[model samples]
Structures are given as structure tokens and as C-alpha cells.
Target: MIACLWARAASRKQRAGRESNREQLTAAGNGSAGPMSKKTLARPARGARGGTRRRHLTVLFTCVGRRVELIQAFRGSAERLDIDLTVVGADKSELAPALHLCDRRAVTPTVLDPGYVSALVEVVRSEGADLLIPLIDHELPVLSQARQRFEESGCLALISDPGVVSTCRDKIATYRHLKKHGIDTPRTWLLEAFAKRKSRSFPCFMKPRRGSASFGNYVIHDDEELHTLGRRVPEPIVQELVAGFEHTLDVYTGLDGIPRCVVPRRRLEVRWGEVSKGQVAKDPRLMEIGRRVAQSLPGCRGVITIQCIMSARGRIRVIEINPRFGGGAPLSILAGADLPGWIMRERLGEKPRIRMDGYTDGIRMLRFDQSVFLDRRGELL
Candidate 1:
């Protein structure tokens, strides 16, 4: 039964692809091949119309924190596909900014809670969500472990393998994995090991072994601060403080776990560990490094964000890897990567044409704050 369903989906994708080709040809013949608008570019090619009459596709985003831009991207993708998309947002708090923007909303248990997985599964079942996208680091491992259970309930969970998630979550594990793949990574030492050695120079960086959003991260310029932070930070790991330009690469791999596209964006300014100002960098060296990193992680699927630094000496050193969409992914999408649209097509069993250099270079993104108002009755204004 599963094979049959997949076969049917593949057939539909082929028909749609052919139709899209024909439309493009028609447009070219009419001498109108300049550039397509966003709406036209997002529209799926016309295909046969007799599967399910009411084609409702629900995508549930779990741990939707401050990803309002990501939610908007998916909403735009659904509009382009002309699908009846009901975006369901789930978070542990009602005050999550993205929650108010969802079509339906639910508050889920924290990932460490014993009932977290069950609560998420219940939301998927009750809302009839067709897909699940996890947005936070801690939830990735949990969701990846429960992926098969969600699949059994006829919902697709967009997550990497549990082992891959584990590696990405732990700084020590990530450093080791990348270094083993012949990738240059910052030298790392556990807090205890560093404390014992006491031989390395100061001005090193330290952070929790398993944390995100730049929490509990510090740069110690002297032995005094190092000792102070070592006692304050939890499970701290010391790493060489890299000096150079930092870049974030947004990479997308297909369901087959093969990387299809990579977008390298240089970080100009960051706030709260999230990119506040960035520019699309079309450097070939950075692109090559991104490709190599994506190809090395065989268990990674969907979107993987890599952080690296290009030193003053002109060598690239990897810093971290997050096996999900990064906070600044919207910048890549706006630069014409169209990742959200590609994800939607892939989820429907369609293969999107790979365009590694599709996005424009030197496109800058400047982010600003927006306000959301609520009434006394707790309703959105």
C-alpha cells in the first residue's frame, strides 16, 4: 500500500513537470522570457485533477519560537501551490510570536517533558497534519526518534536521523565529526580537560556543550574570566576563538539524503545569535565548502545550516552545524533561493530543478522589529 501511494505521487509529479515545461516553452515562443514574478514562479504546473476532491494539506510547526518569517515563507509557498494549507503552530508558550500567525495553534509540552512526543503526536493526529517541521534544537532529537511513529500515522516528519541530530546538538561531537571528514574545525576541549591543562593561551571562547541561541557563551581574555565562566556555565567547552568573517550556509538535501542546493550568506551583524544583517555571498570557495559539508553528513535530510569562518589567512574553519532551518533562512529565500517552495514540491514527491547559483549575489538583508498587538480579551488586533 505504501509503494502504491508513492508510485501515484511520482506519476503526478511527472505530469506536473511536463506541464511546467510546456508552459515555459509557450512563454519563450511568445517572446516573453525575461523573468517570472514570484506568484508565477511559485505556481505548480497544471496536472490531472482526480485524486482527493478536497485536497487539504496541513503543515504543523513544532516549537515555533520567533520564526515568524519562516511561517510567512511556508504560507507563501502554500499560496503558490494553490493548496488548502492550514498551518498549525505548536509551542510551549502562548506568547510565542509565530503562534498568533498560524491558522490553528496549540501549546505543547516542553521537549524534556516525558509526554512531549505523545502530545505532539496527538496534535498531528487531531489536526490531520500532513507534515511536521521542528524548529528548535532540543526538539530535533526527540522528533527524529519518534519519526517512524509519526510516519505510521500517515504524517511525514521532516527531521534528520537521530544519530545526526545527536551529533549536531553536542559541540564536542560536531567538532569531532567535521574534523574526521577532513574539514577544518576550531580546536575544542572540555571544561574539565581545559582546567587540568591550563597551558593554552587566553582569549579563547567558551560555551555550553549542548545549547543554542548563543546562550551562556563568552570570550575570556584572561585567566580570571576563564575561571569565573568555567564555574558559571553548564558543561562548558573551550574552543579557539577564530578571527575572520563568519558565514552561514543554508543547504538543502533531498529525501535521498543527497545535497541539491547550497546558499552562502555572510553575516554582517548578529543579535541574540541570530543574523540581523546579512548579504548573499557568491564566492566559489565558500560554496565549495558548503557543498563538502553537506555531502559529508549522510544522515542529514531537509535543510541544514552550517556556520564557518574564513580566517585572515584565507582558510575556512567550520564552527557549528544545525540540522534544521536557521533563523536567517528568510534572507536566502528573499535572495531567490525559494527554499520554501522547493520543500513544498519535494514533500509532494516532485523533484525541483537544482540551481546552486540561482540566487543573486550581493543582496543585503536588514532586519527590523515589528509589533503585534492584542486586546484585553486575548484576541489578536
Candidate 2:
């Protein structure tokens, strides 16, 4: 009887919270109704008096590369909620495929450039973007550091803390952080330390400390190969290679810094370091690891991709953590994670109910390319 009563109370509280959120959204939209002027781009606009208002939210996606599927997912979510979502895609190249699919498109300077953040801010101001989602790995740290600037302009930047970004960007720091948190990660050695010790095991792995896309990653079977690659790859780090099945976990946390969902995808086939074929796994061990990693990084928000290897003996070792959305996140989304919807709801001041067991297991994704057309004049057709 006590448990039933508690369940009833919780359900009532959830309903009340949702009602409050809806009221707040409606009130804000109504109060801000006005002519669609340049100044009005920064926020949602509502209709005056008893007239209907088209409530809209503008979101900016930076470094959008082959992420058309993700943008479409957001669009689909907005349509379901009756929200006018303006998706603005920004990239360094105008020809990026995803750019053509956005409601508005802009070419921004590279993240390495000093003016990258400023340029992005200007785009946000001009487009009236309410949210900014950085898609690329290298750009994550830069945007994370400038998150406050974006927020100050009425745009929320979905990024982890700068410290977490740094740790994820550098493999050496990533291993240290995981081990520090009592998480199992592969044993790693700095290039200099490995050279000095000369006692490292064979069949080790070497990769750039700050690389992405599986670039500069190699399996070193001997000291000679390690030395050769160490000279070729900059800032190389070696790790004890664990032969096992790899898995990628899509961990989503709310702005309150609490993990709300974890979807572990088993990698079946990888092409160019990106998952070309994968399946969602409901393994409890993987879920627990994802939860622990999420809790470890309290400042993490949105989707964090964790890479781990499970040995034949069932020992799990976390290999990498990317604080941004992974290349294979579309698979998890298709498996019913609804991360895009969750993010939109949370940003609208709605507390999304955590559905840890919402996703389907053994659901597979086989990726293929789709074409976009352009005219000779370089305009999208």
C-alpha cells in the first residue's frame, strides 16, 4: 500500500511539473509576440491578444559533416511537438552535404582560427539561434570554453566542461581520468616512457594523443614498428592492445549534470574508425560503466560517446571518451533513444522522464550514402 501510494504521488508530481512547464512556455511565447523583426530573432515570437502564435526555436549546428540524418531527426522532433525549429548548419566549407539541408546555412572560419568563436557568435546573433551544438571533435574544446559567451547572447551551447573536453581530446589524459575514477581502461604509456623502459609488451597499439577518425592509429607488433610510427605520428601514445569486441556507448545527460540515458552499441564492422555496422546492446555491465563515466564527469551535457573493449573473459576496458556526439549516434537514435527530442524538451525547461530501458536491443544500423544535388551555379537544387 505504501509503495502504491508513493508511485501515485510520483506520477502526480510528474504531471504537475509537465503542466507547469507547458504553462511557462505558453506564457513566454504569448508575452513575446511581435512583428518578426531582426531583434526578435533571438527568441520565440508569439501572437498578440487571442491570435495564434507560431512558437519557434532556432538551433545552430557547427562543423556539420555528414550529419544530415541528425539534423533531420531534430526537425522531425520539432514537427511532432508543433514547434517551428530553424536548424542552421555551419561548416568551414560551403559544399558540406549537411549544409544544404539546414533551414539556414553559413560558412564559418576554422575552429583553429582566432575569430572562429566570434564568427559563430555573430551567426547566432544574426540567425537568432537559441541553441548551438558543436559536432566535430577539434571544435569541442573551443566551443566549450566559449559556452558562456554563447549563453550570454541567449543561445545555449551544448558542451561539456573545458576540463572534460581536454581530458577527452587527449588520450593520455583520458586513460588517467578513467583509472582515477576506478574505471577499467587499457594500460597506456607515453612515448618517452615506453622508449626509456624498453620493457613494454608486444602487440601494443599506438595512436596520436590528440587524433580523431582513427587516423594515425596502428597496431604495433614489435619495437621496430613502434619506433617507426612514433617518428611518423606526432604526440604518439602506446597502449596495451586488448583483443576484444568493441562497443560504443551513447550516454546522454541533462543540464542538471545527471546522466539520464545510456545506449550501448556493439560494433560489428568499422570503416575508417567509424561504425559502418552496429547493433544496440542491453548489457548491464556496459550500462553500469556508462553510468559511472557519466557521473564522473559532472559537467557533461548532451551526448557523450564512450569506446570500450570487452575481452573474451568478459573484462571491459574503456578505451576512449569523446565528449561530443559520435559518428554512430544515429544508430542509437534509431534504436529509440530519442536523444534529439530529449535535448529539445530539456532546453524548453521540461524535465524529461528518464527511460533507461526505452531502447531496443539487437537493432542494427547499416550505413549508406545519399546524394544531394547542386546546380552548375553552385546553388542547391
Candidate 3:
């Protein structure tokens, strides 16, 4: 496979008018697959008299493409907690750099394939995966539905309920749900509905309603651009253009369906759709909004990534919600909120000590490009 490069961010002055901070840094990432060799399928630890014991956790990621940092973070957390951990990855492509990094890896069908879920479930069962984290949005719905099958096999699929996943997957449904719950989201409409209105707004935002990773997103300057770009996108939705500082909130929830931590990080730069340069803002307002979402979204478990913008007047407008670990979650994990550790500990019947605002503020993540060299035999060099 060829090397993949992430472009360096342009100078601040050059970027001032180039991209909207609001929507450019969405937190979606490539799906991860599962590997084997380490599964926390060990016996339940003893109590106080049981004393502290080392546990094992076999973690699997689906569509595991390029999330090296995330995989490394989980490994680091396990080390700190004295847990025996085996990282497994599942992907259709052997060329995925992160797939090669897993403790074990398996090739699988694409998320769109009818056999995708069955293939993944088989991976979990075979690998003895204790936790399954689905990285791509396209697979979330199917994973949510088959969660029981995973549980029956003693694997915890880290996914929200089917209804919660549906609400987040559809952009139109997201807008309506946020509005109904009294959350401030940008005014949005389907392309057909927005186009029929005679009074049209310029400089609106348009993207495929079911899209991710900022793909097919356009900032329309006029009716001509709107119609032109809208046609180019599949199942487009037009939104009233918003202005403000873009911030992504990484929210972590407990098994009881309650949120325990929320880390608000400001996106300073982005490569593709993931955050390239981000700083932990640790704003209380954003934390409150995250809590509200946890309240509004029933049956929501595990980590949920949210994108939003805040104006000079302190008004916050929510943009999108992703019910999985954000691509930039490494930054928050580094700030001291070990979400992966917490999730595994909880699954192992250990209580995690978490605080809503304990993460370090002002710690910035400045990303750079690195390449993996592989030989003709597909072996890492």
C-alpha cells in the first residue's frame, strides 16, 4: 500500500476565510477491526479481601484503518492499570496501517456488505473480545441491532441503543431531535424543501444528510452554488450558515447510562475531517450541554462525540452528534480522563473514579504526519 499524507495546516491568516470552524472538524474516523491474543475473559477478581488483582481485557476495533493514536491510547491505559490487554483490529483492507498495528487482525466484509455484521460478530466470538468499539458510522446501526448476539457470547458491544443510533445517523432527524429537546442547533432542511422556497439564503451549508468525515460538504455562497453543489451531493441537506468557534465535546458515559466526563476541545486546525490541532478549553457551558444530551438521549451508553459552535455572545449552537469515540479522543484521554480504561474496568465489575471536570485545560494536541513503510511482502519495515 502507498503512504497516506495529511496536509500541513496553512498559516492562521491564510485560513481565516478558507474554512468554517463550525463544520470543518467533524470527529468521524475510519472503522477498526478486531485482533486476538489477549482477552480479559479471566475469572472475576476478588473483593477487598480479594485485594487488587490484575485483569485482562481483549479489545476489538472495527474498520480499523488509520487510528493508530487511539489504539496506542488504549494500550497505554491498560499498562497504567495493570490489565493484560490484547488489541485486535478488523478491516476489509490489509493495507490499513492501524490494522497491521493490532495484536492480531482479521480481514472482513465491508460495512455495506450484508455479511459485515455476522463477520464482525464471529471475530468477537473467536477473539474472545471483551469490548467491541465500532469506529465507523455506517456500521453503528447494524452493530446496535446485533449487540445482543455479542452479549450472549460474553462480549460487550460499545454501542448505543437502536433508536439513539438512528437519531444520530440521520442529519434531518438530528436537527428535529435537538430542536424538540430545546437544544440550539442550526436551522436545517432537506434540499428539496429548502430549494422550493422563493426566499433563499446565501452562504448556507450543504452536505449529504447521511454523510460523515466532511465528505461532499459545501459552503454555498448563492442560489446557483447551492443548487449546483446540492445536486452534486447525494441526499443533501441545506443548513443556515453559522458562525462561531468550533469545539468538539468528547462525552464519556457509564454503564448506568449516565455521563461521567465531558471534555471540550477547540479545533485549531483540521486535516480532512478529523482534528489536527486542538486545545482543551474545559468550558463549563459545553460540559452542561453534553450533560443535557446524555439526559435527552435515552439508552445511550459509552462514548459520544459532539460538534458545536459558540458565538461571541456565549450562545452555543449544536451541529452534530457521533455515538462513538471521536478521531481526536486521544487528546482528551491524554488529559487524564482514561475513557477506555473506565469502560473496560466497568465491564470487569470494577468501579471507575471519574470527575466531570478533571481533565487538564489548555493542553493542546499539535498533530504532524508520519508514514509507515511496508515491504513488497506487506510486512512492516
**Global lDDT of each candidate:** 0.77, 0.79, 0.79
Candidates ranked by TM-score: 3, 2, 1
TM-score against truth, every candidate? 0.85, 0.86, 0.87
Q: How do the residues 1-381 of candidate 1 rate in per-residue lDDT, one tens digit apiece? A: 122332344334324434443221111122233332221113222221225443356778989977877777775655566655667788888788777666676777788998888777677666666678899898998899999877755577889898889998999999999989999999999987876784877789999999898999999888789888889898999999999999999988856677777899999999999899999998888888888988888888889999999987779999999999999998788787888777766766567897878888988888888655668975666
For residues 93-162, write the lDDT of model 3, one tens digit per residue. 8788776566676778788888777777777766677788989898899999998877766677889999
Question: On lDDT, who's better, 1 or 3?
Answer: 3
lDDT of 2 at 275: 95
Error of 3 at 36 (Å): 14
Model 2 C-alpha lDDT per residue in residues 1-381, reported as the tens digit of each score? 122332343334334434443221111123233322243324323211123554567788999877877776676666666666777788888778877666666777788999888878777776667778999899998899999888776678999999989999999999999999999998998888887874778888999999998999999988899888899888999888998899999998866668788999999999999998999998989998999998998889888999999998989999999988898887888778888878876766556787876888998888776767779976555
If ranked by lDDT, best first, what sequence of candidates would result? 3, 2, 1
Candidate 2 lDDT at 38 equals 45
C-alpha RMSD of each candidate structure in angstroms: 12.8, 10.2, 9.9
Superposed Cα deviation of residue 295, candidate 3 (Å): 1.3
Q: Evaluated with TM-score, which candidate comes out highest?
A: 3
Taking the candidates one at a time, how many backbone clashes does each contain?
A: 0, 0, 22
Give residue 90's lDDT in candidate 2 (0 to 100).
Answer: 86
